[model samples]
Target: MLEVADIFRAHGPTWRRTVSLSLGQLKVMSAIEQCRSAALGGHVLRCSGCARTEIAYNSCRNRHCPKCQGSAARRWLEARQADLLPVGYYHVVFTLPAAISAIAWHNKTVIYGLLFDIAAQTLRTIAADPRHLGAQIGATLVLHTWGSALTHHPHVHGIVPGGGLSSGGERWIACRPGFFLPVRVLSRLFRRRFLEALTDAHRRGQLQFFGEHAALADRATFAQWLAPLRTCEWFVYAKRPFAGPQAVLAYLSRYTHRVAISNQRLLAFDERGVTFRWKDYRATGRTRYKTMTLQASEFMRRFLLHVLPAGFHRIRHYGLLANPVRRDNLAKVRDLLHVAPRFDPPSDDTVIQAQPVFICRHCGAPMIVIDIVARTAPIRAPPMSRGAT
Candidate 1:
């Protein structure tokens, strides 16, 4: 199995040459490398049943750290469980034209926000139209900034209800049985709404373009570039509706805490640069897992390009799922679904609030920490925890 350290050891120095490190990303990498080890403070755990030892260090808990996202996903899923509606859910993707993608890369904060805002607005407006479904839909939008190959591919993944409350709020209006929304209409509306927002931003001088965007900064040039997009078809894909509520939750769980890449996909690394397996969408079954090499600096640059602005939310809720009405909407949904009332449990007084658990994977025996290690000094490693299983 290849670890992140192996890849870095193989190509990190070369990447450092051309990859400009933002103060923020440099701090993130340093933190990830130091996390949950003796570089910080560590505590010893001893098994009561046997003389087993385990050493546990503090986790950096940075959102960008690949090691930390698993626990974060679990916690986020637990919270979202209450928000789940007992109905079929749809997964829709809204993407921008390549021409707009260039500007998006430069003005990530503004353009990304515009993408979310306009897409949400379009869906709500269209769904509420009497000629359409005429319902107030609820959705959660998740932003993903990378492709399977780790290239910059910004898009939004939406989890929307199969139906919504009618305009009169008297009855539930279901979409055409399995489908939640029309993809063709969604594409056109999404493109128009996005361009409208972009145009407004440009008029207000809220957008900035550099290098490639230099020509776009000119009013006439920008207008000319945007003019062709009005008639151009945008990409809006609708995945088959989820099998059930659990599937929806499971799917959302995967995207909610995902980073650029997971550890499992990393294959190997060497002086030539990092080589990792990526799925080629154009290829069929057997040839999908293709390996690609990137200059280390290029890899680092692509990785850091995705760090969102501080306090900007990558996951957002709209309509019923919006924070203000979430609790009430959830209760109503449960009632409509004939689910039992949610029960409140008394808080546990005797349960320990926090305890580090490091147990052997094979034998289910606990590990105890018999020795402590400091970053400044290296010494003998303690024996493996009792049977290490």
Candidate 2:
């Protein structure tokens, strides 16, 4: 299968020399090139029963690398499985208008953080209103900055429970089984709050401007630029509730760890350029699936567009799932629902295994690691003390 790594490995050195990139993008490119290669080292595996030998390389394990997120998504889902509630789960998306998306391309750290904060605030505020859901809702917000075609589209996906605890925390208030907050309501309020926050950032000089957008550095010019967005309807979409809690987790897994593009989507690469499948969201039916080919440099540029700001978190929790007290809040909610509270396993209850889990392909016998190769050091024999075992 063709991969983002293949493209990077083939064209990265030339691309890096030609383009100006952030430290984060440089690091991501380097990591993808070296990932699972001999440069990063590996382990030599010996089948316990079949006496077969095989070598497996290590991963770069960088968050942005397309090849490195499967285990991460699995581990994250395992931990989140415990947080599932008996109630329905709704998927809501809050998206910025194109003008804002343009600004966000340059001011990622500031603008993206604002998106998450304001989007969360919008959900909580609306859900708490007596005329709306009238409860305190919880949401796991995942920030996706790229559209299917790698355009600069910034949006937050909110996985919200169909209902929330009453403000008093005494009883659960359930949303209608298939519905959560109204999309129009969420859109209107999200637009207002986000514009307001963005204006404040501009006033405080938190926003930066360059190239075609250098005029935005002026408060007056920026305010005028933001005027149309304030009046236009913002895009907020809420999907029907998931079939069950497990379905919700499955859905979350798809979006939470997604990179700009996945290896499975790439179709071909050659002198003609890189060909990949993408969904043209504007179209309907079978025509929606389309393949796009971009020059190697353009492809790399698009991929790097999503390198998150250093230390910025793409996933965040809000309301009842707030980090400081989420565990206690979840326990309290379980008690109300008459479900058993989830407790951490007792230290002695679980056994730790250090054995290699891979099986020998030829004989179907479990494989054991006999030699560990370090990337920066010469190969060494196993210690006599451990080998004696």
Off by over 4 Å in 2: 342-357, 376-389
TM-score of 2: 0.94
lDDT of 2 at 185: 87
Worst 10 residues of 2 by lDDT: 378-387
TM-score of 1: 0.87
TM-score of each: 0.87, 0.94
Q: Which RMSD values do the candidates have, in order?
A: 7.2, 7.0
In candidate 1, stretches whose alpha carbon ends up further than 4 angstroms from where it belongs are 5-19, 341-357, 360-389
Q: lDDT score of model 1?
A: 0.76
Tens digit of lDDT per residue, candidate 2, span 181-293?
A: 88898888889888899999998989899999999899888888888888998999999989998799889889999999999999999998999999998999999999999
Instruction: Quantify how close model 1 is to the true structure by its C-alpha RMSD in Å.
Output: 7.2
